[model samples]
Target: MGKARANTIVANTIVPIAGEDEGDSRLPSRLRKWGSEAHLSSAVARLEALLADRGFERMPWLAVAMLAGIGIWFALPGPGEWLIALGLCGLPAGLALIAMRGDDRALLRNAAVAVPLMIAAGIVLIWARSALIGTEPVAGPRVAVVEALVLEREEQPARDRVRLIVATRDPLDARPIRARLNVPEEMDDPRLTAGAQFRAKLRLIPPQRAAVPGGYDFARAAWFDGLAASGSLLEQPAITREGGGIAGWRSRLAEHVREQVGRFSGTASAAIAATLITGDRGAIPDSDGQAMRDAGLAHMLSISGLHVGAIVAIAWLVVVRVGALFPWLALRVRLPLAAAGTGALAGIAYTLLTGAALPTVRACLAALLVVGALALGRQALSLRLIALAAMGVMLFWPEAVIGPSFQLSFAAVIAIVAFHNSRFVAWLRGKRGEGRGEGRLERLLHAGLLLFLTGLVVEAALTPLVLFHFQRSGVYGSLANVIAIPLMTGLTLPVLIGGLVFDAVGWGAPFWWAGAKSLDLIIALAHGTSSLPGAVLQLPQIALWAVLACVAGGLWLALWSGRLRLWGLAPLAIGLPALFLARPADLLIEQSGRNAALLAPDGRLYLLRNSTSFSAEAMVEAMGKGAQYGVEPFAEFPEWPGARCNGVFCQFEAEGRVLLVAQRPAEVPYGAMVAACARADIVIASRRLPADCQPAMLKADSSLLARRGGLAVDLSNGTTRAVRPQGDRHGW
Candidate 1:
C-alpha cells in the first residue's frame, strides 16, 4: 500500500492531473524546461536576450541607420542647421555611454546607445559632404559667348546629336561652372573630344524642375552632379584646341567597336555592343531602350554590379585554370591568391574602360572587396560585405543614396543574400541532397528551378523601388529573365568580350558575328515578352510615408534572423497595398497656368491644350492610369455632360462645384470674364485676374501660379497642393 502511494506521487510530479493543465502535458521534461526558459521574466529581459543573440549580426544595421539619416537630410526643405547641431551634440553623448559601459553584461544598453549615434554621424557626414561639393547654378535663362573645355562627350546616334559636358566660367560671377551642351551630329567636328577647348555662342538655362508633383527631379540630380546649366550651341563651335585624354581613348574605342559590329550585323546591334563594352547607352534607339525596360533587362546596358561581377569571375576562373596546367607553378603558388590579384586588376581595367561612371565605380569597389576576401581565404559574399560597400558609397557620394540605381542594386543584392540564407532554402538544399544519386537531367532541372526562383526574388525585391521611382513595374520580368539572363550573360557577353580581345590579333570576325546573332535573339525575346498581356503594372504616385515603411520593413526582413524577422511582414502589408490606394489629384496646373488637365467623371483626362508636350505627359502619368488612357482636348469634348466651352473660356461642374477656366483671357473682354467668374465656385485663369473678378473659393491665376510653382487640386474636398510652396529654400 505504501509503494502504490509513492508511485502515484511520482506520476503527479511528472504529468498534470485531469482538469489541471499547466502547459502541453505531452511534452517531455527536457522540452518543458526549454519552453519555460524561452519565456523571459519581462519584455526588457526578452529584448536584452534578443540583442545578445544578434550581437555582431547587427553591424549591418549601422549602414541602414546612416541611410535613414541621409534620407532625413534630403527631405528637409532647408539646410537644417538645427538637425546638424543636434547630431553633433548627440554623437559625443553616445560615445560616452559606450565608453562608460566597459564591462556591462546587458547588450541592449550598448545597442540602444549605438544605433542613434551612428545615425547622427551619418547626418553630419552627408551635411559636410554637401557643403564641400556645393555649386552655384545659373540663376535664370541667359545667352553668352562661352569658352569652355570639354569634360565628357556622348554620341547619340539615334538622335543625330552629340552631348558634351563642359567646364566654363560663369560670365555673371566669373566662377567655374559645368554646363551640358547639345550639338548637331551633322556638324561633328573631329576636334570635339575630351580635353578639347572651344568657344561658342551659347544659350544657357538652369536645370529644369519636375513637370509635376512626384515626378523625376532633374534639378536635384544636376545639383549632385555639379551641373549648373544645360543648353545648346547657338551656332557651330570653333575648336580652340585639340583633344587627347582617357576620355578621348574611350570615345575612339567605342566608335571602333560600333563600326566593327555594325559591319557584320546592324545599327541596333552595334549600339548594344558599344553599350556593353564602353557604357555609352545614348546611341541606343529609344524604342529598343523602352522594350528593354519593359522586359526588365535594362540593367544590362549599364556597367553596374552584374557586369563587373561577371568580369571578375571570368578573370578568376581563367587564371586558376591556366595556372593549373603547369604542375610546378600550381604546386608552388597559392592559386587562389594569384587568381584574386589578377581578377582585381581586370575589374579595375574594365571600370576605367567603361568611363568609370558612378555605378561602375560602385561595382568596382564591391568587386575589389570580394577579391580581397578571396585572397585572404575568407567568405566572398555576405551581408557584412554589402554593408561595407554601401557605407563606402554613402561616405563618398551621399547623394547616390537617393538615386534609383544605388537603391535598386543594393536592394536586389540584399534580398538575394537574405533569401538564400533562410531556413527554407537550407531545407530545400537538404531535399536536393537526398537526391545525390540523381541523373544529369535532375541536376539541370534543379539548376533551372533555382534560376527561376532567384529571378522571382529579384523582381519581388525591385518592384517597390521601381514603382516608387518610375511609377511602373514589370509583371513578366521573372519569366523573361529565366531565358534572357542566360543568353546575355552566358553567351552574348562572353562571346563579345572574346571577340574584342581577338580583334587585337585580327581574327575576331566570326566571334563578333556569333555575338551579334545571340544578341538579336535576346532582343527578340525582350520584344516578345514585353508585348505580352499585362506586361507592366502601372501604379499611382506612392506616398513618401508608404515608401519609407516599405524600405524599413525590407531592411528589417533582410537584416534579422529567425522567425522574429517575420514580423516585418506587418509594415510590408501596409505599404504594398498603399501603393495602389493613393488617390490621384482631380486637377493639375502647370506653373505657367497656360496648361491644365481635369479628371473627368469617367476617369478620363481632359486637357486645356491638345499637345503631347512634357506637361501633358506628366499630367496623364500622374493620374495613376496607363498612357493608353490618353487625354482628350477640352474643345473636342465640350459636348459631354456638365461641360461647356467657348473660344476664351470653359465651364465645367466637378464634385458638386462649378469651375470656370479662362484659357484665352487676353482675347476676351474684362466684363465677360468677371461675369463668368462670379458664377463659378473656382476660377483658374491664364493671366492675372482683376480684383473684381473674384471667385467664392479660389482664384489660381498667373500671379498665384508664379508664386506657388505647379499646382494639383482635389475637387472632392476642394484642397490645393503645390509642387513648391512659399519659403521652400531647397537648392534644387
Candidate 2:
C-alpha cells in the first residue's frame, strides 16, 4: 500500500481513539499512553505557567517585532542593500528554533530565544547594508546617468500626467539601486508603456523628506517605491532595452494575456481577467475598484490566501478525479500524491501570475505547508505546525512581517486553525452518520458550515489589524462572505479554469465563450450584490487602548472557551464606548489645492472648496467619516465661498466654539474668538515651515494640537502644557 493508504490506516486506527467524543475533557490516545512523555508535558505546562506569571504573551511579542521592523526601516541602506541584508536577519531566529527539539524545550522561553536571533539577523542585515552601501546620498545636485525602465505608463485620474517607473542604473554611485522614477509631468505622458526604457544625463539626487511642518515628504513615497533618488528628464540621450528578470517575464506574459482577452472581449472584461490573473489593477479605473471595495468583494481581487487556496483546491480535485479514472496511472502513482502535486503546481503558477508579490509569497508558503503535510502523510496537523510554517516563512522573509498583507493573512489563518482545532477535536461525536459514508451535498454542507464559522473567527481575530491599517470595520463583511464566498468557490473557480484552458488552446475552442460568459456573469453578480447601500461599516481613528482591547478580546476568544467568550466581550464593550467618547478633533480642516473640508464637532461634514482636486476629495472623504458618527457639523463656512480664499475657520458659535484653520489671521480682534494659530488645530503649507514654528499654546480655555513634520506640540484639556505623540523632548 502507498503512504496515503498507510496513513489512512493509521489515521483510521487513531481516529477511533481521537476523533470521537468520549465527552471527557482530558483523554489521551496513543501519545497519551506514552507514560514517559508525561514528565515532558508537565514540565512544559509548568514553564507556560511561569510565563503567564511574568505577563508574557504572543501579542506583546508581536508589538516588539513591529518596533524592530520600524528600526529596520530606518537602519537599512538607501535601497540596493535591502535585498542582500534582508535574508541574513533571520539567522538568529532560525538558529534559536533549533532548540525546540530538545526534551526540556518547554522550560526555555521561546520568545527569548527567538526574538534575539531575529533582532541579530535584523542587525546583521542593517549593518551590512548601511556599512557596505556607504553614505546615503542626500537631496542635492549630483552628476549622474538616468536609466529609466518604464514599468507601466498609465494616466492617473484627475491628473493629466502619466505615472511611470524609470529603471535607474548608477555604477559609479556609492549605492547601486534599481528604482522607479515618478515623472508626474503630463506633456511627456502618452509615449511610454511597460517594456520601454530611457537613459538621460540628469542630476538625480536622493529623495526629499519632511524638514518642517505641513509638507508631504516626497522622499517617503519615493523610499517606499525603492526610488532612492529623483530627477527630471534632463536630456534623453539614448534608449536601451531593459529586462526585469522574473518580473519581466511575468509582466510580458501578463500583457500578452491582457491583449488576448481584449481582442476577444471588451476592455472591462480584459481588465478583470488581467486583475484576476496577473494581480495588476493599475489599468482598472479607480471608481470601479472603489465600488468593489465598498461591496466587500475586494478580497476576491487581491491575490491572497483565498485566491491561492481556491486555485489549489480546484486543481487538486480535478487531478484526483481524473487520476482515479486512469487505473494504470493511479496504480503507478497514488491518487492522493498526484492530487497534492497538482495542487502544488497550481499554487506555484498562481504565485508567478501575481508577479510574486510578498503577500502571494506568504500565501504560497502556507499552501505549500498544507500540501507538503498531505504528501508527508501528516494526518493530524496542529497549531504548532501552522505556527512553525508561519515563523519559517516570516524569518526567511522578515521584511514581509511588517506589510499589512503578511500580518492579516497569517492572522486570519492562525485564528481559524486555532478555533477549528479547539472546538472540533471530537467533531465526529454525537452524530447520526459517524460511522457511515457521507454524500457529496453532506460534505459540501459540512465544508460550508466550517467556512462560515472560520470567517467569523478570522474577522474577530483580525479586528486589531483592520482598525490599525485600514481604519475601518467590516461589520457586514461576514454576511457578505457567507453569500459571495460560495459563488466565488463554485462559479468563479470553474470560470478561471475554463479561461486558462481556453487560453492554451486556439480561438476556435468552445470553452472560450463559455468561460468569458461565466466570468461576465460572476462580475455581474458581484456588482449587483455589492451595490447594497449598507454593505460596509466604516469606523473612526481610535486610541491605542481600544486596539489593545480588541486584541485582548481576540486572544481570550481564541485561547479560552465556553463562558470565557462572555468575558472576552468586556474589553470590546468598554472599548466601543471609549472610541465614541474620544473624538479627537472638533473641526477637521482638510486642505485641497481646490477646496478644503470642514468637519465640525457635532458631525456636520461640509466642503469649503468645491473644485475637483485630489486634496479636496481626500479631505471630503475624511470629514465625511466624522459625519458617520454623528459629529455635530457647524454650517458651511468656506472663507472663499465665491472667491479663492486661502483659509477656513470655525469660531465661538455662541461663546466658546473654537475655530480651526490652516493660517491664523494677523488681525482678528476678539480675544474670545481665539484662533488656533501658534497652537494650530491643523496646518497645511505649500512651503515648509521654519524649525521655530514650534510655539506655546495661546489659550484662554481652548486646547492646541501642533505638528511640524517630526516635531510636535499638543496642549491638554485647556492646559497650557504640551505633550508629544511620542514621549520625547522634541515632542513639543
Candidate 3:
C-alpha cells in the first residue's frame, strides 16, 4: 500500500513539458531531447512535489517579496516613480494570473507571475507611506524663541538632563513640527509636563548624519520619527498651560513607580522598575545598560514580546481562576472566551502605557490575534499568524522593515515557531506523551532541555542581525537566556507588576523587595557572564549583500518544511564566514577632511587628530578590534613602522603605495609640497591643493571631501568609496 501511494504521489507531481508537443516546431532539438530524458523528468517532478507540499505555508513568501520591494525603495537614489508606475501597471496582470483556477501543473507558473507583482506592490506601498510621512528637515542651526507643547519627557537623573519631544509651529511656515530638545535638569521648570504649553529660547540644528560610512544614520531615524530638529535649550522654559493628558499621567506614574521602588531598593532597581512599567529607559545607568548588552540580556529591558506575553498570560490565568470561583457566572459565560478577551485588553492597555513602541505594538497585535484564535477554536501559534502580524506592521510603518528591532524580533519568533514545529520535535513530543508516568524530576529535565533548545535556536537566528548592526554578539547568550528568561517571566516581572498595583493600597513594600532582589540576581548574572573571556564575539562590518543573503537563507530554512529546507545551509555557510573575513579600509577620511584614520599592518588604527571623536571611535569599531586596541593618535607615534611625520607633512606606505598628508601646508615650502606629491600615489590635505601638487593616483582635499562626504580608501587596489555619493538627493 505504501509503495502504491508513493507511486501515486510521483505521478501526481509529473507534468507534461512543452517539448513533449511534437507539433511545436519552434522548439530546439536539444531541449526536446533533454525533456525526453528520464532523469530530467524526475527532477521536474521532485520540484513540483516540493511546491505542492508547501501548500498554505507559501503565504510567508509574500511577506518576503514585500520586504524586498521596501528595500528597493530605500535603495533607489531618489523618488522611484518609474518603479512605482511599473508595479501599478503589472498589478492587474499579476492578479489575473493568480486568480486563474488550475491543477497542480499551473502552480509554478502562477507563482512566477504573482511574486514579482507582489514585490512591485510592496515598492508602491512603501513609497506611498514615505511620501505620506515626509517632512522637511531643519535647514540649519538657528536660535529662536519657540512656543511648543511637550509631547513626551525623558529624565536622566545621573546626567542631570531632561529630554523633551515637543510639537511646535515652524517659524518659517507655521506648520506643525516636532523637535527634540535637551535641557539641563536644573533649568527645567517643575510644572513642565506632557501637554503643557511652554515658550523657551532654543538652539535647534538639523539632525546629524552618520559620523562614519555605514554607521547609524541618526538623520534617517529622526526623519521617520517626525523630528525636524534637535538641540539644547538656551534658557529655562516658562509653562504657559498646565498638563492633563495620558502622556502627563504616564510621566507621573513612571516617577511614582521609581520613587516607590527606590524607597526599598537601590537606584538601579528603581530605574529598572520604572522601565518595566513605563518604558522609560533614560534612568538606566550607562554601566548597567552596557552590562545588559554584553550579557545578551538587553532584550529583557525592552518591553517587547516576552514582557507582553507574560502580562497577557497572567491576566488570562487570573480571569479564569476568578471565573472558576463563581460557578453560576461561569455557566452562562464561556470562561476561556472571557479570559482571552481580558488578556487582550490587558495587552492593549500595557502597550499604550509603554508608549506603543514598534516592538510592543507588534507583540500586542500578535497577542490579540492569538486571543481571537482561541475564541474561534483555531491554532493560536503558526507562521501564518506571524506573517499576518508582520504584514500589518509593514503596512503602517514600512520604514521599520530595515530596522534591527523589527528584524530581530520577528526573526527570533519565527525561528522559535519553526524549530518547535519540526518533525523531530513533534516526534519527541509524541514519545514524551506516551510516557505519561515519568517521574517529576524527568519532567523537569525535559522542560529544561526544551528551554535550552529554544534559546539556542533564537540566539542562532539573531546572531547575524546583532553582528550586522552592532558588530558584536554575546557568545554565551543561549545559556544565559535559559536561566534569565524563567526568572524574569515567572518571578521578577509578575512581582514588579504586583508591586505597582498594590502600592496604591500601601501594601507593596514586600513585593517591591522581592522584585528588587530578583533584579539584582539577574544583573549579577549579566555581569558575571559578561566578564568571562570570549563571552562576546566581535566581528568586522559585514557587507550589505552578505547580511541580506543570511536573512534570505534564514527565511528559507524557517518558512519551508522537509529535506528541501537543507538548501538554506548553503548560503548560511557562505555568509557566516564572510562576517569575520571582511577587512577594514586602509584609510578613512572624515567628512570634514580635518581628521582621518590609517590602518597599520599590525591591525592598529591610528587617528590623524590628537583628539578622539565619534568618527574615530566608529573607525575603531569598523576595524573589529573592540576596545582592546583603542585608536592611537598619530602624533603620539609619528615615527612608527610604515609611517612618519615631522609636524607638517606625514607620509604613509601601505600595500606598496605611498600616501602623503599635508597637515600644515603653510609651514612647508612650496617645492617640498610639490616634491612630496610627485612621489606619493595619493595625497590628502587639510586645504585645497594646487594643480601642480596633485598626486599620481588620487587627491582628497577640503573641497573634494565637502563634495563627496566621508571616504574609505583601499590602498591595495586604490579604490575609494564615498559615504554620500555626488548627486545624492534622498529625503533622509
Candidate 4:
C-alpha cells in the first residue's frame, strides 16, 4: 500500500540519515512534504550551480577511464571488421563527440552525463575483449617488462615475502604488476619508498581462476582495484628512487612512527602503530592476516570505511571535549564546524599517510560528505548530498561501482541514513515519552532491536548478490560481526590510536602493550566464534538469470508491497528449477576416439572431450563443479556397471549390455563406481556391452553430431530433443 514519492526514492535510498529505520511511518510523510516542487527545484538548482562552476573537477576520472579504455582497445593485436567498426568507427566517433566538442556549456553539460556513461561502458567491453585475446586457450610462460611505480608494499607471513606495488608504465595491453620479493631477514634494501620506480623482469602468473564455478574471481576483483597482474621478482626488480611530493613527508612521518614502535616493542607492534597513524600495515605477518580473515575480524586489518568513520568521530569528540576548556575560543567558533574542519584535515593527513587506498578514499569521501553538510550550515542533511557525493565518486572513478567495498560502504551508509530519519520521526512522536509507559531501558532495547533489524535487512539484501559474485558468505555473520564490532569500536582501535600518539612522544610501550592485549582478546573472541559450526557458506556459481532474478526479487521484496513482492519471486522460481535442468551429467556416452557433447545429467555446467568432434567446452564450463567431484577422466568409462550388469535394462545397448571401460590409465572400479560413490544416482554409458546388464542407458554422441546437432538424447524415454548449449567457448 506504500509507494515512496520519487524524491523519497532519491533521499531515503541514496544517503545515510543520522537515526532512521526502514518501516517508520514518519519518513513517508516527511518525504511527501519534502518532495514538493519548492524543495525539488531548490536541490536541482544547487546541483546546477555546482556543475556550472566546478565542471572541470569531474573530467579527470572520465578522461582516465576513457584514456585507459582507448589505450587498452588499441593494444589488441588483431580486431575483425566488427571490432574495427566498434573501435575505429563507433568508439572514436563517440569519443570525438564527447571529448573534443565543447562548443557550448549547454552541449558540455549534456555530454558530461552521456560521455562518462559511454566511457564506463567502453571500459567493460575492453576488459572482455582483452581476456578473449587469443583464439584457443592462452598458455605461455610470460616474461613481463614492467616499468612500475610502487603503489603498495606489504609483507606476507606465509613465506616471509615482501610485496611491492608496481603500476605499469607502458601504454600496452597488460595488467599492473604487483611483485613480491623473497627478502631474507639478513638482507637490506636501500629503496622502500613510494614513487620509487623499477623495471622488473619477472616470471608472471596472470591470475589463477580456481576452475570452481562461482568461486571468488579474485583476478576479476583485482582488476577494478587497479591491479593488472601479480608476479614474483625475478632478479630483485631494478629499483630507482623518484622524489615523492609532500606525500613523502607523511611517509617519512609514518616511517618515524614505525621505527619508534619497533624501538619500544617489536616490528609487529610497530606495524600496528603505523597502521593506526598512516593506514600502513605492510609489515604485518600473513598468519595474523589469515587468523583475522578466518575469525571475521579481517576488516580491522584494513583502514576501511568503518575504521575511518570511527577515527573521524573519535577525533571530533576528542577535539570538542578539549576545546571546551577554552571557553573564550569556544564562544567564537561552533564546536560542530570546528570538529568538521579538524576531522577533514586529520582525515586527509591519515589518507595521505596510508598511501590512499581505495577503501580509505571511500571512507574519506563519506566523511567529507558529513563535513560538507556542517560547512554549509545545514541542520538537515539531504540525500541529494549523498547522491552528489556518489556522482562525484563515479565521475572521478566509475570503476568503483564494480568493487565490493564500494557497494557495501555506500549501501551501509544508505541503510544508516534511512534508519536515522525514520527513527528520529518516531522518537519525536509520543513513542519516546515516559507518559507512554516506556522507560530508558525499554527505549535502549528498542534501539538495539532496530539496529539489529537494520543489519539483518541489509545482510539479506546483500547476501544473494554477494554469494553470486563472490561465491562466499559469512554464515554466522551476525554473531561474528556483533562480537568483533564491540572490540573494534571500543578497546582495540582507541588504544591503537593512543599508541600512535605515544610513539610520537617516545614512550609508547605501555600503550602498545595494551593495544596488543586488545588484539589478543579480539583474536580469542574471534577464534571462539569462528569455530562455531557453519561459520561460512561456500556457494556454487550461478547463471546470469539467477543473478537477474535475485536482484529483481530483492528489490521487489525490499521496496514493494505484498502482491508485487510475490511477483518478483516469479523470476527466482523460474530460474532455480531451470538451473537444475542444465546441470552436468555423470556419465557421458559416445563412440570411441571421437568428440561428443558431455551431457550433465543434473544440468550443472560441465564439459569433457577426447580427440574427436566432442568439444570439451561444456565439460569445461562444467569443469569447476567436475573438478570438485573428480568428474574429468583421462579416458572413457561406463556410467554404472554393478547394478546395470546384474538387473537393469539398456537404453541404447549396441551388443545388449553396458560395458565399463577406460581408454587410458584411470581410477579403479570404473567411472560408474566412482560416480556412484560420489552419490550420482543414474548412469549413462556406451551401448557396446552384453545383453545381461539391465537398467543401463547410453547415448550415441558425435556419431549423430551431423544428423542430430544440438540434441540431448533421453535414453530413459527413447526420445531425442534439441537444446542450444551454453558454453564459455561461444565467447568467454
Clashes of each: 0, 19, 0, 42
Assess the local accuracy of residue 338 in candidate 4 as a C-alpha lDDT between 0 and 100: 85
TM-score of structure candidate 1: 0.89
Candidate 1 achieves a global lDDT of: 0.81
Model 3, span 613-721: residue lDDT tens: 6676676666675544333334323654767777788887767888788888877778888888999998878787776886888888877875666788888888887
How well does model 4 score by local distance difference test? 0.51
What TM-score would each prediction reach against the true structure?
Answer: 0.89, 0.68, 0.88, 0.57
Candidate 3 structure lDDT: 0.81
* lDDT digits (tens) for residues 31-68 of candidate 4: 67767967866765565565566453333334334533
Tens digits of per-residue lDDT, candidate 2, 636-729, equal: 4553233233444333220132323333333333442232335443333323333344323332121222221222112234322122222322
Across 448-470, the per-residue lDDT of candidate 1 in tens digits comes to 88878888888988988888887
Ranking by lDDT: 1, 3, 2, 4
Q: How do all the candidates rank in terms of TM-score, highest first? A: 1, 3, 2, 4
The model with the greatest lDDT is 1
Q: lDDT of model 1 at residue 366?
A: 93
Q: How does residue 209 of candidate 3 score in lDDT?
A: 70
Please report, in order, the local distance difference test score of every candidate based on alpha carbons: 0.81, 0.54, 0.81, 0.51
Which wins on lDDT, candidate 3 or candidate 4?
3
